[model samples]
Target: MLLTQYLFQADKPLKTTIRNYTEADFNELIDIQKECFPPPFPSDLWWSEDQLGSHIRHFPQGAICAEINGEIAGSITTLIITYKGQDHTWEEITDNGSIVTHDPHGNALYVVDISVRPKYRKTGLGKLLMQSLYHLVVELKLESVLGGSRMPGYERVKDKLTPEHYVESILNGERKDPVVTFLMKAGRTPVKLLPDYLDDPESANYGLLMEWKNPFFEKTK
Candidate 1:
């Protein structure tokens, strides 16, 4: 089944709440990353305390968490940047995850990371977190929300297909990638295929550039 179908399957409503992640949530964020991106995903790539601090300090509005029954189930971290609207690497754009480059006056919201604990994956926590980010884009009047999504399914076919072809297959409905498909259903459009975007062997170091334009974005004079 496609991710869209799976993610939307009938289920009981969750007692969930989405709110900005605070310094108090730092340790939980670390645990979530481990559950979401275990080994083969380099431990170094996980968010550091310094990086989390940068997120909360630089642009707290762009960093959010989801709670289910008062337990932190997932989180999304982001920063505001004057997007150059060109091909770029994850480390470069995110300042190696510290986001010290976050510009409060920038016009775009860049998603640095989003993670949901394994136990809560089916509770729609991911969707809720993304919805919060979408709301942030509109609330800040940014032009768009940008993110690089790993294609964990890519490594399986790396020997048989190039990264570009892999993404094309997903886009054309000839294939299904959990991360890619889920993001598509969440309203993110794939605008580029990025290579060496991260150190995840599962994705073969490939990432998909996902964008969601703010429908309410307006040019200022």
Candidate 2:
């Protein structure tokens, strides 16, 4: 399916056009990433322009960008992966590298990254990007979408609670975590808490494994 057609069909709140990533978007996206995730993040964790290009080359449709006023305001990078029904960690999937491990025949759409520029965030661009992912999942006939959710607000209470407990609090409404709350509101469920999932100081090096099943997906032999 054409990315343009999907964007036109999906419900969006802002005046934005969602399209596949391009080489020119590389620098803007890198700058946006820097703004969204501030310093203290390991330099090696950041994907170089070439690595971002590799993702676009491997999964063109999976690399989506939201354009607002002729500028790249947000982006979502994804890949297909065979999800084994077992406990998994982020490192096991990415091999602790910037390169994406996209499996074309995999059954699940694995979201590698999703970010909205700091200036444009909370303007509904993030939701639009997620809608693009939903459309992509339908287009690919994938069963579900999966990704790690950084608990950015965890550090405030990390000294008193375990990662699992922190996630439980968010799930049960006992506490509010920015990323976890966003994912839950987007129809994703927190399946597990992964320790040391990413090198983010804000999340205390932890992540919540989130999944959203495609209600319209049909399984075939």
Candidate 3:
């Protein structure tokens, strides 16, 4: 499915399109990650070209990109996995980008990564990317969508509070965390707090375990 939206640039509406990922978008995907995420995190945490290609080949529908005037501005990569009934560390699921655990017939769609280029942020591209994934969840009859949300603003108050407290403050509106706030506003609920989730200092080495349940989920016994 193709989705189109308008993003304003100097009071002029620029056409933005959301479409499935293609093999040609590999380099731009890496470039966008560099632009959106801080150093080391992009290089240290992102999937390698071979891993990304493997994921796309396995679950093409879960990979998507947003473009404006032929430029790739944002992207979302996802995979399917059975729900692990306990708290999970990032390494346990992603396997350090090997993605060896991606289950094609799993019930939940896991958002491996989602990012928007710095210049295109706040132009609604991020929301569009997520919405595309949500629609995919519905189409595939999945139970929910899951992912870790980085608390980019956590470092500002890390010395004064724990990761849990920081998340609580943001949920209650006492603080505004860039990533958590955006995910919450987009209808994802914070289910748990992940400590040492990644190497990013901005997130205080923490993340929020989040999920968006599919409203149409039905049990088949």
Per-residue lDDT of 23-126 in model 1, one digit per residue for the tens?
89889899888888799767998888898998888877778887766678888889988877677778988899888889989988898888888887766677
Candidate 3 runs further than 4 Å off: 38-47
lDDT per residue as tens, model 2, 100-183: 677889999887888888877666667768878888888788999998888988899989987888887887889898878977
lDDT of 3 by residue, 12-100 (tens): 78799999878899888888877876775547655568877876777788878999999999888888889866667666776665566
Candidate 2 residues lying further than 4 Å off, grouped into runs, are 1-14, 42-44, 95-100
What's the TM-score of each model vs. the native? 0.90, 0.87, 0.91
Provide the overall lDDT of each model, using Cα atoms, as 2-decimal numbers. 0.83, 0.78, 0.83
What's the C-alpha lDDT at position 179 in model 1?
A: 91
The local lDDT score (0 to 100) that residue 214 gets in candidate 1 is 94
CA lDDT, candidate 1, residue 149:
95
| TM-score ranking, high to low | 3, 1, 2
Better of 2 and 3 by lDDT: 3
Top-scoring candidate (TM-score): 3
